[model samples]
Target chain A: MIRLHRCCIALLMASAPVAASAASPIELTARVLVEQRQAAADGTTRIVLVPPARVTPGDAIVYTLIYRNTGSQPVPDLVVASPVPGNLLYAGPAEKAAVPEVSVDGKAFAPLAQLRVDGRPAIAADVRALRWRIAAPLTGGAAGQVAFRAIVK
Target chain B: MMNRILSPVALLAGTGAGLLIAPQALAQQVRSGTAAGVSISNQATVSYSVGGSSLTTSSNTATFVVDKKINLAVAELGGTPTIVARGATDQVTTFTVTNLTNATQDFRLEADQQDVSIPLLGTDDFNVTSVRVFVDSNGNGTYEAGVDRATFIDELAPDATVTVFIVANIPDVAGITQANVSLNAIAANSGQAGTLGGDVVATPLTTPDSPTTVDIVFADDTGLLDQPRNGQQRAFDAYRLGSAVVTLRKSARVLSDPVNGLASPHAIPGAVVEYCITVNNAGPNVANGITVTDALPANTDYISNSLTVGGIGTGDTCVLNGSIEDDDAVGADESDPYGGSFDGATVRATLPSVTPLVPLNVGFRVTIR
Candidate 1:
């Protein structure tokens, strides 16, 4: 990363006068930082617990999830999911994106909730998020956020 | 004392009178009644005062009126007389325009508009907002080629191309493999807006709306429907300006009072209605024995707006020196916004003071009637 930074600085110094068509503005040292400005419901119902903003090589980063329903309505069955980051275990309590029936890779998902609908526990497959699913399908006017982290295997 | 000699009836009558007099005395307690009077004669003199409140008091007269009672006086809008388009269509087929407002709209329509409104959807879905054609008094829809209508712009000069229209994503427009389209171009009219205020937005609005939708102007974007006129007879027949030439396009602003809701029958006190009027060039051409004239509509009373015409011939300015006259319509109705009260109307003329030769800029009315 240090060498990459030095290389970027050398490249910037080589090209002068052409200000606009320069390096990517979102790059931090090397990799581009993806700014996902996802809103739960307009500005009213939102839950932005990075749940796991950072993760160590082998240690799981814990998140204290806190969410509120700022609007006048309630939220329903919402699912939170994320691709299990490399070299980490989802530590029993998790919902992964991959599965034996659905997983392309060995990565699999397990729901963190046991919600019963119509007097029957909902199948765990129903709660798993897809490749690009949000933290949850927030209810009307209701805000709910959760916490999860990948532990180093 | 002479007061003690009063009868019982007189004492009772005096007691009741004293109670009523107490209010006037209490009102006068504010000091400074130096002999003024609010005339009980029922005659009201309205004046539009901008700076201070419309209130004055004297010993005998009190003229205290709220600001709401005063009419808003706006400057006469539109400086130079502009040619407003009535109903115009440029079609390869036959075209027709009848008076929609049922009044003599001072506008001209040139056929061969190169564009006309045809229902892109079902024929039932397409609507013609207006079709006011400048027809001959004889009532024949076809142009006599060289008579009544004037050709201001022809083949090349009538080339001010404008294309704007409402295109919807309805099913009927998509069904045709190939079809001819139509759209209507209307000359701007001076009256209430065609579309009511509510129809503008499908949803409820936080504010009320204007009366006329035609005034809701749209910029000309030739990109919408600019297909060349598919070979059509698009020419205007000319009108020879005669004694009934009726065209004196005079417009200039003079210092005048203000009036708002200009069409309203009753005016605000202290309102200086800056009246603006145009005696148009109902052209054919200015004839030798011509008497260019104009009549004011009766719906509104002429308050105080003077009329003047400048730059008549070369550098000559002329004034119509006389009291204006008002003509009354026999059985006119006032259900609509304009055309004044169902009474007599005032008329003014815009003729060059000394008519020797050349076109004249006859103007009138800088005073409230």
Candidate 2:
């Protein structure tokens, strides 16, 4: 009777449906861009975006991060983080999203109002790294973008 | 006849005995006269009556030896030698001139350079300009212009000493191992009045002595006839003029965007470059009022308020970040050890003082245009 019962349990476990492993749905890409102003024939200035190779002091540069859900299902609790280069000073966020959190040492993160440097409220220039938390789920085949601007010190 | 014979015999015997005692007394008197500090005299009294009464009287006699002696001795006041720098004036040497004379007298001062022969040390001779002699009024052993009396020492009392200053200028020359200056003081005649006292008399007793006195006269009770004439004393001092040695070194480096971050920084536009000027004083003397200047390099512009002057400590690290200011303007901080200013395209930094074997650094930053 014990052997018959054990065989019945194994068959029942084998007949149950097996769950498949989930694949990462979000894909990320980052790049740095510089702005160039050209004079139009009408005597008006127009800004042109170009890839950055070399920059002079007091020049402004932009960092952009793009994300797309590559899988069929939606991605939740998505977090993207980018560090401000040591030689560049953080100016401000490039886009308006859920206000991004900033870190002075690239270790701890907090909202802009809560971030403190040397026991005092930190300014934008003190930011060393920034992180964004997506509030809405990232739908499949949907792309999202975020960016920040900095000056070459 | 018997009475007459007795009287004659007695008279002869008495006369002979008196004569013998008189000779012995004369020999004793001569022996006593040879001793020092002793006076001898003898008196005889005679009683005689011309007509009826007797009279007595004695002759008066006085004897003394006069003292007329003058001696001059001089010596250097301080045992240590003096140090004099080239082209320095009023390099004074103090001396004490004491009058060993029994009477008041004057002394004339003169400084003469002695011939020195030190191998490898430049010629021992150097011209001493603006030689002035003065009597130290305060007796502090240091020369003070207004306090000291620059006058001929007249009427130096017997056994009195006076301090003398021989001021002279050192010529601008090097390698002087032993620059000897001799101060000579010679005794002058009585009533001599002048900076250069009247020429020494030919003889201390001459009615009108010669320009220079030959001998000093001394008369005493001992009746000694030999005494030195107008005496001269001398004091010498040797001076060593040291050299002031200084060396300067300059280095420049770009503080931003170094090619390898460790060495060989590239000079790029809009980059900051720091220049360091090191001034070293290796001599034994302290250097004062040291000024360092550097012109802004071509293709670069000076960064205002970026200058910093400091002292190079043990390992060439900059210490004392002195306050910077515009050229000739007062700095906000007064305790800074250095002061800097800009004139046109050049940066000037002034250091208050620098000691031997110490290095001072003057640095400033400039941005390439």
DockQ scores for all predicted structures: 0.00, 0.00
Model 2 achieves a DockQ score of: 0.00
Give one digit per residue, the lDDT tens place, for model 1 in B156-249: 1111221122111112221112112232333332234322111111112232332211111111223234312211112211111122234344
Enumerate the chain B TM-scores of all models: 0.19, 0.47
Which 10 consecutive positions of candidate 1 chain B have the poorest summed lDDT?
Answer: B65-74
lDDT of 2 by residue, B5-87 (tens): 13323443443344345746433322211222122121111112222332222111111111234456777777655667767
Q: Which candidate is the best by lDDT?
A: 2
Given candidate 1, what's the lDDT at residue B304?
Answer: 33
Strongest candidate by TM-score: 2
TM-score of each: 0.16, 0.35
Q: How big is the positional error of residue B231 in model 2, measured in Å on the Cα after superposition?
A: 2.0
What value does the interface RMSD of model 1 take? Answer: 41.6
Model 2 agreement with the true structure over A9-114: per-residue lDDT tens digits:
6884454211111233445555566665779899999876654432333346666666666566666666665656544567887646345677666557797678
lDDT of each: 0.26, 0.59
